[model samples]
Target: MSAYKSADQYRDIAGRLALPSQAFIDGEWSAAAAGKVFENLDPARGTPLGLIASCDGSDVDRAVAAARRVFEAGDWSRAAPEERKAVLLRLADLVSAHAEELAVLESLDSGKTIKDCLNEIGHEVPTFFRWYAELIDKSFGKVAPTAQNIVGMIVREPIGVVGLVLPWNFPLLMAAWKLAPALAAGCSAVLKPAEQTPLSALKLAELAMQAGLPAGVLNVVPGFGETAGQAIGRHMDIDAVSFTGSTEVGAYFLKYASESNLKPVGLEMGGKSPMIVLDDAAIDDTLVSSAISAAFWNGGQNCSANMRQIVHTKVKDAFLDAVVDKAKALVVGDPLDPATDLGSMVSEEHRARVLSYIEIGKAEGASLLAGGGASAGLDGAYVDPTVFDNVDPAMRIAREEIFGPVLGVIGVNSAEEALAIARDSDYGLHATVFTQDLDKAFHLAKRLPCGTVAVNGFSEGNVTTPFGGYKRSGSLSRDNGTEAMDQYLQTKTIWITLK
Candidate 1:
């Protein structure tokens, strides 16, 4: 079956959409505390979408206070695990029911393709909620053997109120990533959706309430990073923070925690991941598709985007030929259209930033292969997926995180050279290795130093596997699977003496 509705159908939904424009705090949709607002625009047309509530420190305080109140009052936070699970499961169903509306909203606001948005909103989003809900009661505590007269027990408890600062790239999916586990763990939360994309978050709050989530259990405050984000970071009442964004911004959260309440911070920061095509690997359609998806999916705005391609000299030519051909054939047009393989950058500013990097790649002597700049006659920030070959390991384009639809190919003489170049980055969130030989794949995979290494393909694994980084790319805390619950729970020990 076709994966999406017609462009006219999507536009009709957008035209009549009830754009959320306020903070959802304490079960009410209210304006910013200071009555300030910011313009949210349609990235595809550069037109004003709506006026989002420009929350400041005051709004953050209000949201956190409400979360703390509900948590302490034994509402959602103290509910039975089954109760929380049921509520979350219902929320998942609600998401699926409204999938088309949300997918279109995301595509219009964030400039993500409607097909991708549907897959996430319709399938992945609900799956995350259901997965965490199923895990709620299955998680077991531990008992310790002690002296004959004494008994010891270890159990987990909710970590109280948490701050979830989301990124703009995967608006609802990232919300699902953090919220599912946090809410499933029975912790109240204050969410600060990125100012660039906050409408879906506000809408999510409305849905959570409709799903029987208690008042004050979940809140969303929308505003700029310096105001709403900073307030959440420095809020003394918040018990923990889970952030997914840039490396530079991740550092600031750590500082905020240190300077404020010292709440633990979980960060999934940026990466300069490499897609290594070893000499033994085939230069077939699989490798080309994986390489293209790694670099161009979501326009390469992902934190773990494999913008660096370290291919062996033996197969570099064929790999480049195949990938460039595929890149050129990718349709760069309307995100609402299912045929559009690539869409606009999230905003005009981001498009300019990416175009500048293309200029930088040229100045640094990287050979342009396919794509370079804006798609002709496109209204908004649409960009062609640019590929560059003959990239040196030392060049800025190869080393930095451009977070655009720009891929650079660096030729490596051997698997060892590829490993060395891949490991040279300060970040180690993810890496992809393509090799037919089992021993070589295992060798490179084991020594890659990243959090999750994909063998023979490009993947970040499914919800069953933990996702995070090893070095500066992430912290000790992880997301997805059972590990994600650890971010919102605390382990406690109980010792008793028998009379």
Candidate 2:
């Protein structure tokens, strides 16, 4: 009760939350053009937390038009770097100021733990704004040496009026991931938060306005993917789009782009990432803990979650025992409780999806090592942290991206075999390798075929490193680091002749 208090307190906030009820367009709170509203449910209790404006294509049109006007007006799209930097920094401070309010809001909205909400909204969200703010002036143009008579310059300019499509898993944090970089690069944006969890994003827009962002510079229209998402993708006025979601939906954006404006589309899609442990690696507490954390963190809803554990034969048995022991001890309870290690699934539909995959794993002949029975009496969308052993690479459980707290263990005879198994995936988003030998670590990392590889532990890198994927997992456009700016910018070369 110390950390997040009782269920009564959570219900108290949930019942009377000052949740936003409208779309943000042209820096004002506006309802959907159709005036439709959707039931925003708290996945923890499967109750209606509130109602949010259910926008559609018409709202997208209004938001996009607003973004276009601001871009053309140069109020934000052409603002000086330091000026943009100052505004973003102020927004970051505001996010920090309203941290607790946002944490509880998101925890209720998404069924994510309040602790996770705090870490994301209070820490990661603001860090992104500050990082991009600091990067604003530091992002330099290039000068190319030419013949003495000529001066050649290369520069990056904002790709006017971009559309940003967000995901539900880490709602506010993902918004910051795209928005901070886009704004820092001096682009006007039309943001669409996932309809299921739009509260924090709406709050963020409010804070941005308070931070002195001009009208029409940042607009957030929350809605279903079919209407608002398609509109943003197919909108003629938008110059580019950045998305984080499934591979299936990611392709639709490309289709929308091809059918309409042929806009540049950037995608950070799904993954069935692997955590590899070689025989030479220590089967100690650290290794065991890393294995569990990689697979179960955030209830394994992460895109880069290392849910596929590919371990060498020699250490497989010991590792499995340690993993099972630790997995059994995880507490699944109220998301608001700070002591809770695992929280509720985002929705009943998603919980069913994860449970279906568990049954599929059994039918496909993998052993249910732990979990998949019943979540300890805490109701709603709660799902147990599940693990499967003897998972073959060909099993559906190993190949598919089960976006839940499901972990599958596959054994290999040698390092080569482990590496081979890890690389065999339609996705190449992230991979982890644990090896005592330095040479072996580098060998696996170089050949993993993923965008980001961790040698000793599980990580997607900090804000400074680029994160995307190889193959179908992502586009050439990355989401973090200086590379994120590339998705929202266009290059220009200027040539001059000396007199």
Candidate 3:
């Protein structure tokens, strides 16, 4: 009797796509300096998808050197803003051209639904580049107030070699957020993608090169967080480091940058955001639709996902019922399935973490309104959509980030109490204030201590609008319209006298 199971015991998509297993540096893909590798797992099935190149300190140096070379060469950053604009535009076009393939790959790797992947690749990802492309030349300096004889202009220049560390939640979208503006502002970069989902970023580097981004102008290195992430933070030649991840790690990078070179650090950290439903809010269709979007979209992994819901006591019961009903109706399954509304978490560990939080909710006197288990027959990493009612504002479930399909419903006495509860968290990433009254909406909007506030509906912002957080968020402002490009630039003033 054979004790071993056949290879067919597990699902395989290796033949579907030959995943890149190398660090992309100076326009070429190669193994890490140490010849190490990391296994990326399929979140849906809790199986090893494949081994990808794992880089460390030496690898980080190579990438930084490449970026530095490109910066010094001025082949990309020194190109005329018009020409740079053209290249960025072309890059966006290429992303659009490969939108289908990118979406499939992202879905396979990230465990997000194909529909969401398509939306990211087709819409969010490309829009950043396209918007920044036009803004390349437009991102000029403003003339500071000065005496006529002593005129001065705060001209923006490339921020030199930048290190962009992107999160796994929305790999392509987050990378685009950094890359588009950084490239637009004439900076070369070394991109370190989340180890869990590095495929899309490597693919994107290839696309950028094909669109005429010069060799060494961009590099992608995948590795462990302690190794590559820290290396990027401490690299001497790196002028700036922009990151999006948990607040715990963001703090580490912030300190690393300060200790390393006092290099400017941009961090977009964690959130326990509140979604306020006012007494006058439209409940039946519009309010329910917005609530569903806030709680469950993107599998509740979004940094800006409405984790905490504060409903006015008068309408709390009705709101909870509506939210639970809608959440229960969501289809959870394989990401490749077009109809699947909710996909698996990024990994089994994350899935377990989420479920544990659900358990915590129950133990802490919160009510499980709907969903609290694995799908009956699903093979991949599928967790049922879950909602908790009678949750206290102080409960761990309500305050901490689960990053799963779990919602915590809290009732507040009034809109003022709602805002107070919403503002009580350590995070100020984002919040949505739903109300039919304009005065109430605006009042709540101004009072909420988040980087972005959505009135009447969830925020549907374009690349031009600013999107960032307040306290404990980060040092730099991001997504503020064209201002996103500012992080990638430095300022220089030149004085001259006409002969």
Candidate 4:
């Protein structure tokens, strides 16, 4: 019924794309220093996509040296803002020109639905480039008022030689979130994409060169976290490191920075975000659909995913019925199929981890309201859209970040109870509330201890709004919007005495 092509058609397109398999450094694709490689598998079918360069600390050092050289040479770092903006705009245009190829590569490499890869990430990636491109020329330094005999000015300057470490969930989009703003701030960068999903990032590096980005201005080294990632975190030459992944890994980055150069580190880490549905929420199909989409979008691999659903007791039965029914109706199949709503996890290991959590939920005594196992007749890393009801706030399934298509529903007696339950988490990344009363909506919005909150909506902040987290969910640095450029820039105050 869907207009999407078959599995064979996707294979043909993927072959035509012929995504690069080597690490992108300086300005060329090259083999690893040790000539080592790692296999990338299609999670949808467990088939080998290709081999990516298995870079290690030596490769990271080379890439960082290249970035530092470019930064010190003042090729990109000293370029005029307007010129940098023009080049970034050109890169955005090229991204649009090769949208389909990038989307296919993302879906194939990350095991996300092709439809989402095309519609969500495909569109968002270029928009981020364009957004930062426009900001580059408009953002300016400030002149501070001073004493009559003195002139003071505050100028924002790019921090040299940034290291960007990306996550696998939204490979290209997350890369854009870091790369766009860093480049706009006139910083040279060495990026490390996740080992599980390296194809799209490599392709992006190639496209950057095509857009006239100078050699070493932007480089990507793909490999395991212990090697390439740790090197970036611990590198003395890198002025700052921007990372997006789990809290455990984020803490490690902090340690790496502390033990090395004490460089600035920005992290957007894990979450167990809550979706609160009040008793007075409009009991409509739209509300049910929005709640479902919030928890399962991108197969719930999002760090801001609303894995916890706290519903008021008055409408608990109705909400649970609708949510469970919708979860059951979701079609889990090959990611290439347009009709499939839920696709496989990023890898077999992740699938097993999610399944183990399901068993843990059962052992911990949460009621299995909907799906609780793998999809029938599929051998890939597919897991059904799972829902667990009668979940306690202290349950492992409710408190932890599943990072999968698993939703836990907890019933609350009042608005006070819902707020208390939502705030009882180490992560303060994202949360949402569904209600008709403006008083209740605004009240919850102000009290919820998260970086982002939506009333009667499901989306996180957009390109115009700042996106990050509170507590352990993120660092002081924020991403997106005009403020994101601040992460890669430092302020210097200059004063001159009048003659």
Candidate 5:
């Protein structure tokens, strides 16, 4: 026997990590009014990981009240940029110091490989904080046109208290995306993590507190969407709300904002992103590699996964053949196994959903090139890496977001047709076009209606680059670069005559 046969045999040192269990309100761990609890499950084996305190609408009210008090206090907001940067810098240091514990907990909660989580997500955490810290001091307002002695100065001020809702797929990374910019911009926040993955966010709150963040500055409440999420959406005291999740949930937040406070809503929603392979594209290893990248990472759960493959008709068959061969080689098994190339879906329900979509594709007469079933001999949730050939642009598989390990191959007669096929989706979150022609690459890159485009390269970016979708895929306020700070800030103008 190779060490422990099952995950149960290996004790998760990460779960026993010391972190506060109470709802972080007013900068401390406080219990909910009802003190109700909910169980967080390990999706890999469908086992209980831990019981987290559940927050209801009433608890959200209290948290919002606390956040508003802190925002109004202006201790952190009105303070100098250097002071804010110092606090955030300290928080980043603490995160780096506890990197291993955080990585282990993330892996345990999300069913991702511990190695991948530690290497990618854990390492990126500190960089994000450090990047935002440097930007804080350099960020300043602009002076607009004014007549004569009348000066029009547009200054960025904290946008009051914000309600940040994070998805389960990449808990800490998404939080870092939202939290770093929001905190650096001097906004107090009430954060609600996905009910399924609350451990990391709870742990994060503890670290933030330890890093000298004052009470009521950052509060994390773990609860269900209907109760806690809806409460945050409609909360009167909340100045804004930033969310990252499915298109349906994102739509609901928008409607709630419209009906309630007419507050600004920042959403990073679903994506049916496309990858275009042009006629001039090299038919070698790079083509195969891009195909694998589109529909494999995180079991293809990424919002920007290269789910839709728009290939030139000249090399369409050849590209599809290469992709099928590469995809079939993927090894699906226990997430802890270092050799496992693919991991489980977030949950059994999500696995079933992915499978159902595959069935729908078959029903619509799309050719199943490879992997249309669950992997055999795996006790945990494991779906085969799927690929559909001869898929029509109009098919549901091509139009909608599967959020699974499925790739849709669409054949186009020309480079124009390829770009057309790629753009013919409601989601413009991300797209990649592969071609050796620099003119064609740059031309398609500008013409494609996505928020971010990659020519020759697949979906990629640093914490400093802006990442969001266009049209229905993302909101105006959630871009990730220097502009990200704008989401948590409101422009203010202060004018005075010479003393």
Candidate 6:
């Protein structure tokens, strides 16, 4: 009954894109130094898309060397801010022009729904570049007041070469989050796309070259995290590394940085975010839809996905029933289908991990209200939208990051109990509250120890606001908005004595 594209249609789309397979370095595409390659599979069909270059530490070294050369040459690093802005704006235009191609590649590569790929990845990717491009000209340094005729000035400068490690979910969008700000600040970068999803990053690198970015300004290396990622973290020449991945890997980046160059590392790591529905909430169709979307969007692979849904004990049963009904209604099938509400997980390995977590949830005494398994009749890595009731705050599924389409509902006696339940987590990236009471919304918003809290809605944030986590969810620096540029910039103080 779904209006999904056939296999042949998808294949024709793929052929038209002709996505790049080689790693992009110094404005050119080339094979890995060792000529090793890895198969990139379409997660929905489990078919091989192509073999991508499998880079290693040596490739990372080459990329870093090239980036360093460009940084020293001042082609981009010393260019005028307006000039950098112009190039980024042009790149944004190119991204818009090739939106359909990129959307096809993204859905095929990462198994995200084609609708989301086009809207979130394809359309939103250019916004980051354009936002940062316009912001470049506005982020000026300050002239500070000083004692008795002595003039002091503070100026921001790029931190030389940077290393960026991206995650599998929202590949190109996440890349834009880091890439836009770094380039706007005049920093050269060596980017390592996750091995599972590297096609879009490589494609973006090609587009950057076409947009007039100087050679070495942006480089993409695709490989295993243990090799290229570790090399980037440990490389003494890489001034800083901005990473978005697991908290465990984030800790490793810190260790590598400390053990090597002691470079400043910025991490946008994992999250076990929560969504609280107060008894006084509107409880309309919109509220129910938002709750379901928060848990199942992007197949729940989002780092900031709300895994825990805390509800008032009074309205718990009704809310649970509505959520369960909605979960059961989701269409899980080919991601390329415009009507598909849910798509495959990023890979078979990840699907297995999510399935195991469902079993664990059942074993831990959480009642499975709706679904706890893969979709019926689907050969791909498709997981049904799952909801668990009576999930204990102490349970692993409640406390840890599942990174799937699994929602754990916990009932609370009062607002106090809800606050306690939401705060008791190692990860604090994003949370949402559904309530009509203004006082209650602000009260909960002020107390939640997360980086962002949405009242009466569930969205990460807009371009103007900053995004990052508290505690283990992220580093001191934030991503998106004007604050993101700070991560790639350093300040210097200059003082002059007047006669």
Which candidate tops TM-score? 1
Residue 384 lDDT in model 2?
Answer: 90
Tens-place lDDT digits, model 5, residues 193-234: 988778788888888888888888898998989989999999
Q: CA shift at 218, candidate 3, in angstroms?
A: 0.7
Candidate 3: clashing pairs of residues = 44-380, 44-381, 464-481, 465-481, 466-479, 466-480, 466-481, 467-479
TM-scores of all models? 0.99, 0.97, 0.95, 0.98, 0.94, 0.97
Off by over 4 Å in 6: 1-11
Expressed as tens digits, the lDDT of each residue in 221-294 for candidate 6 is 99998988999999999999999999999999999999999999999999999999998887779889989989
Return the TM-score for candidate 4, rounded to 2 decimals: 0.98
**What lDDT score is found at residue 90 in candidate 2?**
100
Which lDDT tens digits does candidate 3 get at residues 6-35? 222212432467677799999999899999
User: Stretches of candidate 4 above 4 Å error?
Assistant: 1-8
Give me the overall lDDT of model 5: 0.84
Q: Whole-model Cα lDDT per candidate?
A: 0.93, 0.91, 0.84, 0.91, 0.84, 0.92
Off by over 4 Å in 3: 1-15, 143-151, 497-499
By lDDT, is 3 or 6 better? 6
lDDT of 6 at 97: 90
lDDT of 4 by residue, 1-499 (tens): 1256766777678778887899999998899999999998999889998888999999989998899899999889999888899889999988888877887888889889888887755578889999999998888788888889988989999999999999999899899999999999999999999999998889888889989899999999999999999999998989999999999999999999999999999999999999999989976888788789888888889999999999998998998889889999999987877777988999999999999999999999999988899888999998899999999999999988889999998999999999999999999999999999999999999999989998898888788888999998999898898878988999999999998
Tens-place lDDT per residue, model 2, 125-157, is: 999999999999998899998999998999999
**Top model number, lDDT:** 1
Clash pairs detected, candidate 6: none
